[model samples]
Target: MDPNQRPDDERLSAWLDGELDSAATAEVDAWLREHPEDAARVRLWAADRDALRARLAPLADEPVPEAWHTLVRDGGRSAAPAPAPRRGLPLAWAAGLLLAGGVLGGLVGAGVVWNSPELQVALQARGWARPSPLAWTHRAAMAHAVYAPEVRHPVEVNVAQGSAAEQRAQEEHLARWLSKRLDMPVKLFDLRAHGFELVGGRLLPDAAGPSAQLMYQNSGGQRVTVYLRRPEAGADTAFRYQRDGELGLFYWTEDGFGCALVGNLPKERLLALAEAVYKQVEDGIVRTPDGGASRPDSLQPAGGRPAS
Candidate 1:
């Protein structure tokens, strides 16, 4: 293949991981050299990857926690399968990084699960699918990881801390602007019923296209983000869930839009919120064989079924 032919993110990522064969690696190397712009982007990715490794590297030195041993032991006994890795290091490495959390890189969040190979196997024994490498889903998780820690300016538009009417107006404006920009109906899923109120949202840049992130918070001040965008070609509408360090995510596609609800909430809590979102989204569309614009009582949430 011509080096001038641009490599997609996956190839570049593989190059970063040294996962590509020599020929492919050389091709990417040549491509990077000939295209300074591509090289710059790859360099940024390399930096981030290195930073993450460095952040988690010390964990490998600490004594493995007793909990890790127990989980790994039980994992083998239970015959649970680990989550399949999508890129870079194996899932075990990422999963190990979670259990080692304790002021390490300050990446720890609530409701995080240790997803090492054995633990993943255990999760699989319980019939859970590993989080897929769906780009938007990972982006949602990354966005949450980046902004959830902010004590100020977590979102561009904040519906909270404003008068009731102003909040409503802001909510309306957020929905309208994001919908128009992404060319999809951007319903601000009402999670107030589940103890989380809208905190407003902001436009986000996505490699696939323009995306939006809506923040929500509870009385306790815990925050979550809903990342939304139009579905890519061949995007599945399966309601999927994944836990990354402290972040828990439930993502699905509906009515031509892809959405991922991200937070550090427990799986059950996140599921309830996700279901609330699913129901609200379902309410806005009619269910018909042809998906005609009519509502039905038995409509199921997107992602092919409701997440258990």
Candidate 2:
């Protein structure tokens, strides 16, 4: 089906990108039959996809970056902050050179650089750097950013194809645990329709903040994570995305809730998942404030946001 000419054509494109569901996919197929021009557009999309697969499909089987070992060994910092890629598993190639030199690497790797009592002390060391200057919380987001993409050992439990009842049960456990911590109802989505399959989840401690990460895998083996927390007493925060390595992150605070989306998926797919989760949350399906009821728009955008 031509994704370019559907009523929600933009959405259709996202879906064809494997971001849509069975319902939308069928609708697109039907539409394409009626609109030959649209069909042509879909054909072009398929060709582009084929070309990309031909190019990148090989990387899928490449070694899963053995360098990831170094990061965990010394307790890597969450992806490292601004402009700095950090000294651990996900360090920049240049940093690897520094590590080889032994002079710059030892001091930073010792944990004296980034863990100083003051920012100045941490900054004094040369190898103490980041891919982006991020707040500690953002670094937490970065941690998820790095490992969630693994093809092997990506998660503890991958519930991607779990039965409906099983999925709901997992979400139920997630909600109860999260609710107790944040004093809010927590929701989990089966966004397979949106191209992410639940890959189980975990709770971790952050030097900056504690967090919950729900991992997911896509057809491309790219993994996405939804990180949640309660940052402070109460606040509604703006949603924002940060890029690390080849992946992008979408994070925001809403009604005392904190969330981050980390993945290599297209910006559109990431945003679509965020919007859907936000909607379910607002609709009382995922999380609920005292009196608010969920609506269809819960999965929709508002305030001229991209998908509105």
Candidate 3:
């Protein structure tokens, strides 16, 4: 906003966002010190600023491409997902779009689970009734894609901190983490039962946005990954189940997230496994490298579900 056209309150916001020149900022800062109500609003702005920084912190000071705001705000839900924003902007700008949802609400950001072409194909397969196993493969493959690339931390509970055996133990803790959110009697499918042991999982990009994924393998070493995200599209439906080709997939959205159980298996068998695994995988508990569970403290408020 032009400094000349800015209203008193707007100026205060500019000051808070650090948009004003040093002299103007100092002026607004002084005014806020004297005005209790405005000061309270400043505090709110500060909280909001911190929240947005934390939510987008992973992007490495990358510029939220012009398209990101446009995509997010205009309900960019094309079947062909938008490419992730170009990063490494000059970092000279002092202003931001500041999503109207407030910086705090950015915490509710659905992580990377819904942008992949593979996953989008899965969604289309379910609806289009084409060779469907690809959908399941889409889901599992993404889970591996998102988390395995981490540098500082991989799993929420890092058994890697201890012995090699301890690292495997982290797998067990990861299972428990899923169980906690799933709110069910959760367990890794015993190789004898499902022919797969839980290897590990990580977060990933998807058509809907960011998501969590879990990987598993069987005695014969067949593998699967479960991908999860905050639900979008027909998420309110009880469940939209699908199976195509050699892959198996079951997906659902609950609370504020979407989940897909994926594997290379037959339709009925994979559906059952997806349901059972879905029941076992947790909801809303995005685990951090430090082994603590974090939920989106900010929400989109009632009736603000972004359009597909």
Candidate 4:
């Protein structure tokens, strides 16, 4: 098949799910080899599917509730119609619900982990103090996928052009403007040591509020994006990793900021970049060679925001 006529995402997702027959799988493999981006996306979807399965796997082993057992033993009749057995796993339905409503949705609500002892145990085992921020992480990957491929207008602020002084000014303006808008410090991380340079950045509207997206590129033209937003208050801060098809994401929250690095680079390479951004953000300063800070005089016009 012609590369331009590559299969749509449904076919790619089906391939990841092992739903395709051998010939179809082989076709997908050929297409992926020719189109790295699509392959990466499929990998991410597979990773996410696996992670979801792992998180919910324990639910499958929990025995049907006594209420359910009573109903079953009584030939599907009951003196009082017992509410849906919270203790029973209903694994298949739950997985479908997660896929439909979202992974974190319908799993827990308010202070109730569905009022299931088994589910509570599973949550504890999973180290979930609250609903996972997985839904937001998915959004981050989507944002990267949508914007990183653009040949032009990949960023709102064009900081790579103009004279040296003008470029510095633009960078400063970008940092300060995003910082002000986001209500937190936004630092422009320099990744040149790792063979990536600042391309520019854009403002994005997030589900929670305004967010920032910084784009970078290597000499080979491979692009990566850094997504930043204020995390939900009291959210977990542990670093996490997820991949779909060709894209990999390393996301974490710290000091009220949620950050995700999305790229098609190998894990080690992406980790290097993630670590660089993490360290820079933790340090809370982005310095120039002169050891003096530069600030932008005004905010540049912003491109339209992408969906969260």
Candidate 5:
């Protein structure tokens, strides 16, 4: 393979899995070195692959289930066997079903799922099935982990830059630009009451389409991020909280919108901030042209108190 020749998707995927020969590998490696965009995309593929493996690794050593055995032996005629009567069976079955659907390399490389009735059933039985919105919530967490620690260039659009007038202009621009990109109304929530102010936001890739991340900081320099995207039709709307080591997240869906707040603050404090955001969202508070928060005419109730 010529090192200068651009490799196709198949060749790049093979290189990712280490299935390419030394010559092919060298060619692909050289290509990636010269193409930073391709290199970054491959890095995302690697991250997704590692995440999937980590999530399913616990089930690898478990015994194959009797239900799976019966299903394999009886072809497609076997009644959906009982949910495997073991801890790891659900994930194991999921892995098997995914593998049986298509080549694993292609599936992971494309960042997609092999949807089927049986696969859906298996995933739903274990509360593992969800629409793309739920999947991107994990991406929200990853985005926070990657960007929150930066000393500079923490956000793509820095609302904190320049004079107060310039900062306000940036805030409005962030809101309008994200709303346009996501095809949903994006508001810059007022978290100053909870000791956080808008630092800015950036567009992000989601499972379905583009999402947005708004970064905020407190007087003490502690940072938190809010992630927003348009919810898919029939997405789960339940409010959920999750913790990964020291990071705490509060995520929910409402009125065709998905939002997740991620931070390393204590759960109680993070919950307070999340609640503040929820309240502002519920009230339809948006930044006005004069650099103050107010509700739109459609959202303002008769004699309703103005947003603080």
Candidate 6:
């Protein structure tokens, strides 16, 4: 297979579901080894599938409702006498009814009901059916969990891979490549001021599009990740914090960009780091290619405060 030829979503999904033959599986495995973004997306899909299955597993063991059995036995006809067919009903009305039935069936199969607030909350709590802004924040957290623990291959582009000059060049390239792909400014945030140094970054997939994750490590080997993505139109720009088990996340939207910092650090420590990032971004401080900082004139000040 050509290196540049990528598998489509159906192929990847098939690979995830174990629907592919051994040869095709091997090919997908090899391709995933070279493409972290696609691997991440597939992993997320698997996680969702597993979570959904686990959530609904008990229901599978429960006896079917009597009403459902009756409905099935009746071939889905109501117990009440079928109203006399209206002979004058238009074909368009029949088509519309078919479309509505199809849509309703899909919603039911997916466990969604317009009036089921509790069910909707349950789904959102498991990181499903979130609005655009919250959805990407969840992805940021997932990316951090997936990559932050790796010892040797945490990032696709390792800034610490070479000499001083080469490392600087790598940092520049990481910033540039991510910025280009994200269509937003990507800053190699100077976290050394807070005891963390850049370890490089990688591109990841977001719900809407591409996203980037920059990893940083402290002297104690503790790592945190900064996730960046272009903001969806009308996304809320307020600073917010969320906790997912042991991970603490600080996320916000600023200057047409969405940023989230995720780590296993204490809330205070993570907030300090998030504040540092916020300050640098608000000041428009872009880390230069030659290991320096420059504020582009195009950038203007933006105001926001962390949510209490």
Q: For each candidate, C-alpha RMSD in Å?
A: 14.1, 19.4, 18.8, 10.8, 8.2, 9.7
lDDT of 4 by residue, 90-111 (tens): 4343433454544432223122
Higher TM-score: candidate 4 or 6?
Answer: 6
lDDT for model 1 comes to: 0.66
The list of candidate 2 runs beyond 4 A from truth reads 1-136, 145-158, 161-164, 207-209, 234-236, 283-308
Per-residue alpha-carbon lDDT of candidate 6 for residues 1-308, written as tens digits (9 for 90 to 100):
56568988777777776779998888998998888778876765554444444443433434444554565689988767544433422222322232333332333333353236654554454344532435787778778867886665899999987788889889878988998998877778888778888899999888778999999999999999999998888988889898753567999998678999999899999999999888888887765545567888877767876655
Task: Write model 1 residue lDDT over 150-239, tens digit each, in one string.
Answer: 565678878776666777677777777988998876776667667877777889888767999988899998988889988777867788
Point out the worst 10-residue segment of candidate 2 by lDDT: 120-129
Task: Pick the winner on lDDT between candidates 2 and 3.
Answer: 2
Structure candidate 5, residue pairs in collision: none
The local distance difference test score of model 4 is: 0.69
TM-score of 2: 0.49
lDDT of 2 by residue, 143-253 (tens): 564445344455544444367667556656765675575554445655665766666776655445556777877787767788777666554476676654355677777
Candidate 3: regions farther than 4 A off: 1-165, 172-193, 281-308
TM-score of every model versus the real structure = 0.55, 0.49, 0.36, 0.53, 0.56, 0.59
Q: Return the number of clashes found in candidate 4.
A: 11
- The worst-scoring run of ten residues by lDDT in candidate 6 lies at 88-97
Alpha carbon lDDT of residue 257, candidate 6? 87
lDDT of 5 by residue, 120-154 (tens): 45544544434343576777877776677666568
Candidate models: Cα lDDT each? 0.66, 0.54, 0.47, 0.69, 0.73, 0.73
Q: What TM value does model 6 have? A: 0.59
After best superposition, candidate 5 residue 82: deviation in angstroms?
34
RMSD in angstroms between candidate 3 and the native structure over all alpha carbons: 18.8
